[model samples]
Target: MSNTSNFRDAFRQAKTQALVGPNVIANALPYVGGGLVLTALGSYGGLGVLRTNPELFLPTFFGAIVLQLILFFVSQNVAEKGNNKVALPLLATYSLLTGYTLSGLIFVALKNQGVGIQGIGLAALGCGVTFIAARQIGSNLSEQDGMALTKTINLGVIALVAVLVVQLLFSAFGVYTPNWLEIAISGLGVFLFVGASVVDFYILPRTYKDDQYLPAALSMYLTYINLFVFILRLLIALNGRD
Candidate 1:
């Protein structure tokens, strides 16, 4: 009976740790961009990673996707072995690929013609503040889901899929709409992203255990990326108004 009780306590602690880990990671991810920018600056000055206009962004973009996918699978398999060492390298690799892919986005934002350094600075500041505030609040929040939570999460997933589909269609058709529309869409993306963070917050503790860091990191990374994208779009839209 003592052994059984200890086992249960261990499981509970692991779950709690998982819940906290991703939020910590998400908070740290914004800092990673700063690191990448420094690296880019050192290598190519302002024109390093973000300055080059490539007609073939798809190759690098898809390459990042492929790398992320590979890391996901590798992490999953390694996690099954109940060892975290196997997963850390995969996490590091994903982080590097993510940073590389984001260099293009940073470049595009700076070169948007409508957007200037002030606008970029404002957006970065806004996102950094939001990331810190949300993370702090999330760390203390406790989620005990009932039927309502289930329905909410399900709806969140559906909303996410619909938004993604529409975004893809618009991109495919080259449908350049009003800047307000883009901003509105970005606002919705932010809403969805925050919802996902809440869901992840609840999920990590319930579903994760030893060797779960990689999956947790991946989830937080996705949220970070989505948040960044929408924040950038909002900045661009605001700049367009000026």
Candidate 2:
């Protein structure tokens, strides 16, 4: 009788954890959505400000980056300690700062070519496709599959960083890339970031602990932001081509 009772208790505990795990991603959706709205507002707001005080753009852009880095590291530290109280606030602030920086880029693009609406539309479409793919992939992720995806994502990120570094070095040497190469790089960036968002969303529920929802949300938010930036860039590149 005692053996049966222990087995039942263990099963209940396992079931509870399993149930709680998926809610992490579900709960994160609202935060990610909120961040997106904030991004749009910040972009518009930054553009408005830039019209009057263009000199502030560089300082504001770099300031947002520094602030975001600080908030991100602090949020991660608190989340690691399971302190949602501190982590949630930090995450919110970080999201806003990220939006501010993104807004600066949008402002630049708008000033250059007035492609704001089209750029946003393209980003939305990319996000929609990425979300659908992620949902399909996440629904069927076993533990082994999740681990394999994680490894692939890590490798992909490393390769992407290396490629970017090479490009930057070439630029430093005043080496000009062909137009085709620029377009290809822009397209590849969009593809990579979209794939990253899918992987992040797919593994989020399986990977994060119960109290680590903030960190999970942060990861997803960053993925989405990167996806938006890359998609927007790809759109602009194609527009320029035409």
Candidate 3:
């Protein structure tokens, strides 16, 4: 029984590595394509749309989350087939669509501030830098430390959800005031999500190798998107009027 269990573990790891190569390709293409298209739209067409209907922004926000969930389930189902070639393309397409949906951020920022997009840039920079740092630190941690980091990441998600719930409640009540409390909550959220991103990156290449490519790509994709949104909200919380 011990030998059998060991063999299964070895097989799973090998499968995950096989998927990694194709997953990386599928993952990169969507980001590049969707990014270019959205950048153009936001830099040009997005402005007019937001001006005409500000409500559209709500759909973009909600839609991204919904689509993200859908893709997650789909990826899981694809993983069961033991063939990543087809799954890679689906993941890439999902990434592009997600990019298109997120373009609304550009319109929202421009409408708030007159042609300035510093908030968006800052958000991106914060996420990128934090992700890089977390990855390096995660790589260096001892096995025991790594396990502790995993616990931290999980707890961070719970804390993040709690914060989101409170924020939503405040917003719904029409008293969404920005205070030190809110600032602290948002700051903690940023840290948690950044930590989660690093943990996800670390786990992807090793544990989920069965459809390693899709899972890894999906993990990072989710991380980047969450990081971006969190940074944007942090900017709004810090700088926007109450």
Residues 32-95 of candidate 1: C-alpha lDDT, one tens digit per residue: 4543344334323223534464555557667766876676567645744546576656656655
Task: Quote each prediction's TM-score.
Answer: 0.65, 0.80, 0.69
Point out where model 2 deviates above 4 Å. 1-20, 111-114, 142-144, 166-178
Candidate 3 lDDT, 9-82, residue by residue in tens: 32344333222442443444354344434434433543454567667756765765587557656754684455
Model 2 residue pairs with clashes: none
Clashing pairs in 3: 16-209, 16-210, 19-213
Candidate 3 minimal-lDDT segment of 10 residues: 1-10
lDDT of 3: 0.56
**What C-alpha lDDT, on a 0 to 100 scale, does residue 130 get in candidate 2?**
84
Name the candidate, 1 or 3, with the larger lDDT value. Answer: 3
Report lDDT per candidate: 0.54, 0.66, 0.56
- The count of residue-pair clashes in candidate 1 stands at 0
Residues 1-242, candidate 2: write the lDDT tens digits. Answer: 01112122222333222434667777777877876777677777667767888888879888877887777677766875778887777777776677677776676466546365766776778788888887787666775665566556555655666776788799889985666676777777776666666566555655565556766666777777777777776666666632
Number of the top-ranking candidate, with TM-score as the measure = 2
The candidate 2 region of ten consecutive residues with least summed lDDT is 1-10
